[model samples]
Target: MTISDILRDSDYSLDLLEKHIDDLTIFQKEQKSGLTPPYTVCKVRKKEIKLTPEEVVRQLYLIKLHKEYGYPYERMQLEFAVHFGREVKRADIVIMDKIQPTVPYIIIEVKKPKLKDGKDQLKSYCNSTGATMAIWTNGKEIVYYHRKDPNYFEPIPNIPSQNQSLKDILTERVSIDDLIKIDILKTQRRSLKNIILDMEDEVLANAGVDVFEEVFKLVFIKLFDELQNTRKLSTHLEFRNYGESDSELKVKIEEIFAKAKKQWGGIFNDDEKIRLTPSHLSVCVSSLQDVKLFNSNLDVIDDAFEYLVNKTSKGEKGQYFTPRYVIDMCVKMLNPQEEETMIDTASGSCGFPIHTVFEVWRKIYKDLGIEESHLFTAEKKHERALEYVREKVFGIDFDDKSVRVSRMLNIIAGDGHTNVLNLNSLDFSRWEETTKDESWQDIYFDGWRRLKKLRSDKNSDKSYEFDIVMANPPFAGDIKESRILHQYELGKNASGKFQTKVGRDILFIERNLEMLKSGGRMAVVLPQGRFNNSSDKYIRDFIATKCRILAVVGLHGNVFKPHTGTKTSVLFVQKWDEKLCPKKDDYPIFFATMQKSSKDNSGDKIYVKNSDGSNRLDSHDHLIVEHDLYNHDGITQDGIAEAFLEFAKKEGLSFASGKCESPFDEAKYKALLDGLEVIEINFSEVLIDKNIRFEAEFYNSKIGLSDNFLYGDDIIDFV
Candidate 1:
């Protein structure tokens, strides 16, 4: 039977994808087959692939290639094999030249996102087969590239159609305007990151300017060019030839750079020239000019920025970008709504703040009556949606380079910059010079004025303005400089004597709390030592005395990856308000411990795959990579976020199940059982209490696994 026919029970989850692939269609009829067990035929090789979820994705991509791109059947081969270093591996699909059957034209990866080296994987396949193009897709996202040379893969906005030649694609007219029209459906179809990395290897090494500064300037010019050409798709950033001379392209790029600087003054100097030689500049412009940077999902931009910054400032400065997955979990659980102010004190690349802007934008869009289906991709909504970002969110950082990067990211998300200041948030006294400088008046003064209203007092000690705050401060450093140390209450003895030293995060805990007004909620990442160390009893006491602790979730040691192995937890707190805090005698708080850390001990990310060893994909036809304390792809019952939500309902915890003592539907979900005797002994708490007496806490924690529970259809509905 076909998968649709076998799915009569409706027991299986149809979509593990958090995002959708709206651009492509997969016909149910095309997916069904007449084999004995019902397998689908590959359009390329005419071979039967078993009708599993992963195979279904492969078939759809193949159809897109044939119908949309007009790839000839004779040119294609399925299960194409290629050598990877010493080992030989078979790829999903490979397209060959009809004239030269031995020569591979394109290599396609239809495997779910689990294929770690998407670019490198395709590169090796090309090295073996001599394919000129590589495409990777999990159905949610697709990456297209031209294997420019053995060492580089250039990002092409779109691949050529059946009739178009490789030369035509390389030399086609490309405009900044074509990139501004946001196509929401193409969320996963982007990648110039590897291409930029390739550029570094190819020409940037010998470029006269700093690699980061030059590339950043080029990107800035490209973005501004698009902004100026908004909604006008016919305008082009094209050059006459791919093999242009250095001097000619230099003049043109310099003109663009000068204009971009004039338009956006703060980032670049007016006299800043295109440090790249004309030939190199022409190649970069041709490679990047066609792609829409703003339309790409924030993840793509984030990845590129991470690569650039890691090569330069972040590593030496003790700054690391917070993984987007962790940021998503915190945002989801907290659920920031429209009009509520949010800030990130540490704000490394401003991940917390930028995402907050997105969440708020989403809420405000729904409030203004935009359909959820069209929200992300709709160009009409971009300006309307970004207003909350400019008005409500804020950030501060100690590093100037980090501040510049943070501002640029915010500028993209907001479509303009807001209040991302270059200052030491902990050293509030030094903040005056930063805020008062004449050079920073336009960028700083207005936002500073607005932020100043948030302060509880004139002195920087009490700025209780923001309603919500989220931060992952630098953990590897301490405040040895007693000058900055004296600003915090943590820096003093009981008699008010200055302490010699203190943990930087300890001071930040106090600083972040001060930034919040009464009843404002905040989430911060702190070391495990704060929670368990007897030596730090005062820190815990300080937290208890200042705020009502909401929830504490232990994070995997690998969350910060290749950076630090320190065990950390996210502590959610709401500052004391007269109603929710001061008057409360006692309240039960939610407690959780993360079970499945989707990462290995070595800090390498682990992905969810199938029993057959193929990577598992979500409903979006994209690979569902799990990186948090839980898995959220809907393929596993391992989500700690979902578990906590369920627990909140049961325990009548605040913010989850309406009010503190509300009733819970304990039997929300029930596991399916096959033909077996059903005792239903777990139905009663009294019967469970008797068995619980003999069970150790650790033993009970594994209840859903082996002994005392059936092998299949284990504990369901929290019974």
Candidate 2:
């Protein structure tokens, strides 16, 4: 039986989906007529069935899951039907072998605001259908039911975490065996509910809302005592334990978590259980899933509170979660391994670390059949990579809450290493102090130990240090104050400090180098301001000489959330020995740009084919939808990879040929262009080519700004 026919045969999800489809149809029709239709409830009859865009999205996710698992829809039919004769709908989604059709292997019920009791629905459905296994899911929370006897269903523990895609499932990128061993499936509802409740109690107790608020206050007050003297929380920030019955606050918090779930690549239906309200003592709990204790204890209570307060205040924009696609690209390009030590200096929400961890896990498990016991951990049962979490991964953030969140995220990703520390990048003293002390002796520690060690090392002319460093630093500062921006700028004197602008981005580059060993690779997100800006010439020149600029990938604005929108670029480099002074051809720079193309001439059209001419598009296009880069192709999209790979190859070729330092030679480059014309023109022309390169002379209005270079008293320039 077809999926549509099966689902329609038994459940109400189809009806709900049909409602969405009807609305979408109306919306589409209105758009065609240049009209804006008002939002209204839409209904459709079974005979005139249509899938809503939302339903299509959910189906796509399901399809992706199947693809990962190597299961084709042809072999599986999704069955939805009602359970007990209460006219109650249940089993929103069920997977059965199309051949059998009568017996369902698995059943899933998704609850929304309109369809509550998703869990109960699944229970009833399993009893009625005799499905072997049933899942009641609301995205964030899922409860699994296994048949104990033919008539009864009992919960099972330790199902592996869902892979989120079909490919990951099919390849066993994350093991189902491991999932069964860990009893992840069993951890649902029971454990999750208890944990959430305890967490809520703890949060409410602290921050004048829960039992631990006082402890958290004490910790913060002590840590930032000096800043306390200057700009205390009581002074600059406020602590409010919203009173009971604050429905608005609850709604607001729910909205926030909902958005966060969507942004983080987790899906939530309307029926998902969420509670947002201040408790008796006033600590508010707003959760996307049902109430559960946030992992807590007095010692970690402050950390939790800090995360909540900061996360709530900063919201989604502050942490700036990097898109999975962008992170995927970085991981693919760098190919982070278990042996290499990786660090993200400005890890906001620890997105890179999470992505890196999973990517690394996939590689390790695929080849060696190992699973991460914790972030950076190796299972004793199987052969694994090197031990010592601290040696493998590290991250730093200026925000204390970010550090806490990063730590928890690392733990979740199976990395035991929790090295995220709090310190401002601009504060040289703080940066030095934090990195030097393995114990990380808090704010009182001296910051110059590392600098002293560097000065005392006997082998100053020797080998490289770190493997890779990656970051996306803050980018808002002027270049006038050399001292304020010393770490980022080129130095004037021989003794201490690098001269820099007041901005933070350049400082991150310099700091990234300090973290790297010679010949180490690095990938960093930068503002386009670095390119073509007169002041940045020093940095660019320094990079040209000291490092191999392997690739420069220009990104679209709005890659970050709309609020944090800024045109950015990712610069991939390999630091080399300055003393060796390799030939220009030894390390040519690769440049790639993602530009808008006419609807008919998109680069993504042929993006599936790689250099070897193999189709790489078969891998999950997780980046496309997660990053919101889709453009009506009805397929997952990634247009930037082709250009990036092309440029990377060019850069490698230039290095191999030993002829990279030639002056900007347009004539030689022209021949290299495959029928693509390089347009050139002077100022005052009204017309402009959309494909013009930003670095091109004609694109620069001031290149030959003066009429003549020989003398100031030149004739009037032509109009």
Candidate 3:
């Protein structure tokens, strides 16, 4: 039997254990009549023991202590005991001091697979035994901490080896290259969400402070600390705790936070201070110091902020941060150009607009022949990308907390300015009231001014001329106000009477359409029932009359789990124009259903794995989620987005290929002017009697109907 067999039922992996496997003795004992053979191992104890899941991890760690860390076997002890008050507890493993062989130098806890549980146990043992350092792992994630005092156990990158001092590890200088290579999120196989959860369990849960505000402050300060040393290759990150007193660390962090507020204005109050207690803040900084929050897409920070914001006001409105994979797919299918302007009306954390900036940056880099390194998204190296973000990207959200998060991300993308507004998008009639508020004007005035320049009419907020619109509006609530209902054509029925109430998403559908200029494209996430329900025919007809349906992609049910289980589909459409869309009544539309869920029912992400069951990393060393939405930068199989691009090219969609000035060759044009015979026929009469369906899945389900089949072609003989 192998170590994998012992860890089959646990969440832990064998990746860290594999290298030390040969140093230990692992064998299967003889099986009885009804019992399976148990894996046995002999290590630090020099005695045979049945290797349970926990024992397997402990044994692997012991080998690592001896071989990798240069710790001698004589210095290590298994099941070392210590007295706590009147009770005696045993630590899983302990490394004794070099000079004082009886003193505990490092205590490793392996019984608990979870970080919170293991960390608590380690803290208790360290306090009781006066151990200077501690280690905790479940074979998957490992953490090293130094016991600064009785109340605080600060996180360290790694424990010092046998010959090195803890000061060497604490004072080591690192660059952006080193940070990218050893990002805790990748090396520890832990997400920002998981780390936050650990911090909550350790301190924030009982810190007597607002969890959201305190954590946001820490993350904001840490991001600023990372940005400071991005260009300087030899500077040490100031976010960490390096033998400083708790009070001193807090002062240093608050100073950095103040600088961050000055650098990225509008997210926090000018007088705001980190409210966490000095000791509490010290532990939080240590927990977050090693994380590299900036990446190729800022997805690490995005995922964490999504959780924090959703816990407060977002869930009540049925809003969840759109998954980055889903955002990438939407951005890919839209094919937004650098010159085009884009906006997300709902704008939860501004996922759509921020990703659109990244997409445009890719194109700009390709044109300029600039090679992107691991710091491509983190560093502000391109002036044109920054200008595109500052000028062309905009977002609006009704939730104040979400708007702050969105604004922060947008500011990071643009380096200073942000166009993410905090006004309600559906209630545009009252936008003037919001604009007049001096407090709102102080932060959002620049963005609001830029947004006003794109309006189709200077005096109205009813229409806009943006080139692209993408949003996932709240679907669980209804707009009961008549004033909001009376503003949209969709709000009124066929009888021209405004409804008393309308689904929030329905109003957003109309609002999104109005935001786009003629020939502009949009992608909106809506309930799947809107596409297939017979009672929603008028809504479908309303869309058909105004724009050509480009595509409909049905998402998996678990895509928004833990917060919601609503089955949703993204509707892609392009407005009619004389040159670009031409009001086509009969056209082929692309249809697809995502096969991979990308997440489990518990809302945890499922990552792509290697052949040996370890998670796969991309060229940037970030874990790739298993999905069929799009081939993530060519890391996974070609998915639905790739197929749609091919179909778009074949159909010569205006966005895919430039609009043709003439429909005929020069010879054909000359012949037509020279009295060549021309045939004219009215084909509407043939199609007028047949029933038509606008739902993409309806056509997708029919047999022998290819992706390129024209509307009404099956019912009429076009030849």
Q: In terms of lDDT, which candidate is stronger, 1 or 2?
A: 1
User: How much RMSD separates candidate 1 from the native structure?
Assistant: 9.7
Query: For candidate 2, what is the lDDT?
Result: 0.43
**What CA root-mean-square deviation does each model show from the true structure?**
9.7, 16.3, 7.1
Model 2 alpha-carbon miss at residue 98, Å? 34
Over the stretch 1-719, how does candidate 3's per-residue lDDT look in tens digits? 76666678786776656677676667654556655556554566677788788888888888888787899888999889888888889999999999999999999999988887888899899988899999988877888888888877777888899999999987787666677777788777778888888788878989998898888878777777777787563277888887687799888888888899998989999999988888888788878878898878888887788888888788888888899999999998888988899999999889999999988888888878887777765676588888898889999999988898788777776777789999999999999999999999999999999999999999999999999999999988888898888888888875678889888999899999999999999999998778755456678778888898887777888999878988888989999999988875567666567768889999888899888677788998888989888778777876777666655665677776322122324443233222211111222221232353322223224333222223321121221
What TM-score goes with each of the models? 0.69, 0.47, 0.90
State each model's CA lDDT, in order.
0.62, 0.43, 0.80
Candidate 3, which segments miss by more than 4 Å at Cα?
22-25, 29-41, 83-88, 657-719
Task: Give the TM-score ranking, best first.
Answer: 3, 1, 2
Q: Which predicted model would earn the best lDDT?
A: 3
Total clashing pairs for each candidate: 8, 60, 0
Displacement of residue 633 (Cα, Å) in model 3 is 1.7
Q: Model 1 off-target regions past 4 Å?
A: 1-163, 173-193, 225-259, 286-292, 295-297, 372-387, 459-461, 493-497, 583-585, 600-623, 627-719
